[model samples]
Target chain A: MKYPQGVKRNQVNTPRADKEINYGQRGMTLEKDLDKTNQFYLDTKRAIIHKKPTPVQIVNVDYPSRKKAKITEAYFKVPSTSDYNGLYKGRYIDFEAKETRNKTRFPFINIHAHQVEHMRACHNQGGIVFIIVKFTVHDEVYLYPFEHFVKHWDAYLGNGRKSITYADIKAESILLPIKYNPRYDYLAAVDEFYFE
Target chain B: MKYPQGVKRNQVNTPRADKEINYGQRGMTLEKDLDKTNQFYLDTKRAIIHKKPTPVQIVNVDYPSRKKAKITEAYFKVPSTSDYNGLYKGRYIDFEAKETRNKTRFPFINIHAHQVEHMRACHNQGGIVFIIVKFTVHDEVYLYPFEHFVKHWDAYLGNGRKSITYADIKAESILLPIKYNPRYDYLAAVDEFYFE
Candidate 1:
């Protein structure tokens, strides 16, 4: 598959070579699914959640006209918080979502240190915080509450395994079933995990 | 009075000609003051608020090396939500801040319609929503509740005044007194307005 100009390989990971993957699921990334789900929720008047924009450090901007401002130089910044956060049912909701092709375990490398710190802070303050993990090879998704995710994170800090196995995630997290309008209904999992 | 290269006049409003303005209050913009205040709140474990990064639409990037991915083309997107949001005392807190030099009234031209809509959604979901207005000429700040601000905004939509008068704001909103560490103790005002 040809990528658009200036697009990097790792940035747009389209697993076209995986013939085992269903044809219907070719381009549905976790972020795109969540965006659709959030929009669905917004339209249904169920929740008001948003994925934060990619953080960038702007350096120089050029204005060719009075109404137009073009950014000429900028750099991406390491995000210091979760990618998704917003209000839900009179409570604060915060979470990070990741999709891993690895069949065995979800590694901790891509998840930043400050984001976990942020989750911990939010959790301590009584906000509903969690991590959503998707295994592309297995075609499975799980929503792990912050309370459980942090235990493994703490263990990892104390010289435990650097990643949590797929089995452990399956056992600890709520299995989010795929749906029509919302695609992956993670908030249903949230309701089952927290409110129920 | 000299601005950095490419900085627009209205973008960087530094009223050096205001002879009545104190010399000590030269460069303290509302955004800078709030950053300091949020940092202070974080350190004290009082709250976990953060300013959303300025949203930019990145069009082209040039990878100079393996480590450096330089953004070559981008543009600022008009923000659809509030600038600041977080969890405070188990409540979802959301707000926008604006500074104006107008002495008599705060105009609605600077505040966008979508931001007010976002605030309304948050307020409907029971989140603590507000707007912080700083009268640069009067050297005073006020935190106006979403319920109150929306009344004037809706009236404006109904062909009323395009702005809210200084007398109305001073009477209806909480006057946020400046302090040393937190600078603008708006949460104290929040507690007084909501919790009390």
Candidate 2:
């Protein structure tokens, strides 16, 4: 089987191949890094965060051959909340991970009102919600509190800045040690925030 | 301005109308229904729930026009959990909705192992995790609790019954009310389950 360019396929059990992913918008994808990170947490049993299933809204299928069926008509389903969620030491963990090349700032338009609403709901339920932001320019990663993200979400309405600056991120977000396994190391941040 | 057959021009403000949408195998796509349900909930303020954004592993994009871009080379990010989640009356709600035409029993293969783990974490954190099974043949929807799903899920490892029958659903699952706003009054079920 031929894999696409920039996609590194592991031989079943590769060690942190995803963690070492190049995020220069050419070598690897954001989801890969997040997946490796989740795997690290799961393996260590330190936290239980996960990316939810893809909602495939199947409209039609074509069976070109007897053994295989072709999904001729399928629309991506609209989900009901953030991309990643789970539990860590009995606290609900919910969040979204985003990557950008614009080193100056992280855009708020990447987030939607419904996502903000979902975060608030998780908060009401006593769950922790936040975002893992990666600045490929500086090769940096930060976890912005859900509260901060929500507070600044409505800023676009007031002619405020469109993105969260590195300084703002440093002030409002927790910097995670990018590891080979679970590339983002988000649980460490979680430990520092709610558990500690 | 030729649009792909699977894609639809949204009179309701869908951002990706120009993008190709493959609605595979069925006229009613689950994504659209889920979106409508979320919109209804948002408009009515019954329970704030929203689906997470699609985790696109964008490998390549073709700029057909300044206003339009077609994703040519992309692969699924191998998501780690389910599609829907939010809050209802101060409780975290996480679930995956699925459909089956099988008249006798629903198939378990439709679910993934990662989702099971994610549910376990949520359940451990006092979050309500479950599945929405829509028997398209009977036009009946069943909301099965995470415990029940998990129980049956584990059973698959020990001949625990591969699929839960519709009759079993009637006994174990909660029957949600159909309302004008969200259509599925799932919060009522939550109130009945968590409170009582």
Please give each candidate's TM-score. 0.89, 0.67
lDDT of 1 by residue, A34-131 (tens): 99999999989899999898999999999997668999999999998999999888999999998788899999988998999999999999999999
Worst 10 residues of 1 chain A by lDDT: A19-28
- Docking level of model 1: medium
Worst 10 residues of 1 chain B by lDDT: B19-28
Residues B8-127, candidate 2: write the lDDT tens digits. 655335654432232223315555666677777766666656665545454555565554444444444545667777656656678888888777798887887887787787787677
> What would the per-residue lDDT of candidate 2 be over residues A1-196, giving only the tens digit for each residue?
7656434665444646554464445324667888888878777767666676555554554566554444444455556577787666756678888877786888877677666777776776677888888887678778888878766666765767687777878898898886676667788888787678
* Model 2 interface CAPRI class: incorrect
Each candidate: RMSD: 9.5, 13.4
Model 1 lDDT per residue over B1-196, tens place: 6766645775456656554556236325788999999999999999999999998999999998676899999999999889999999999999999887888999998999999999999999999999999988778889999889999999999986899999988888999999999999999999999999
The positional error of residue A125 in candidate 1, measured at the CA in angstroms, is 0.4
Please report, as a value between 0 and 1, the fraction of native contacts recovered by candidate 1. Answer: 0.87
Worst 10-residue lDDT window for candidate 2 chain B reads B18-27
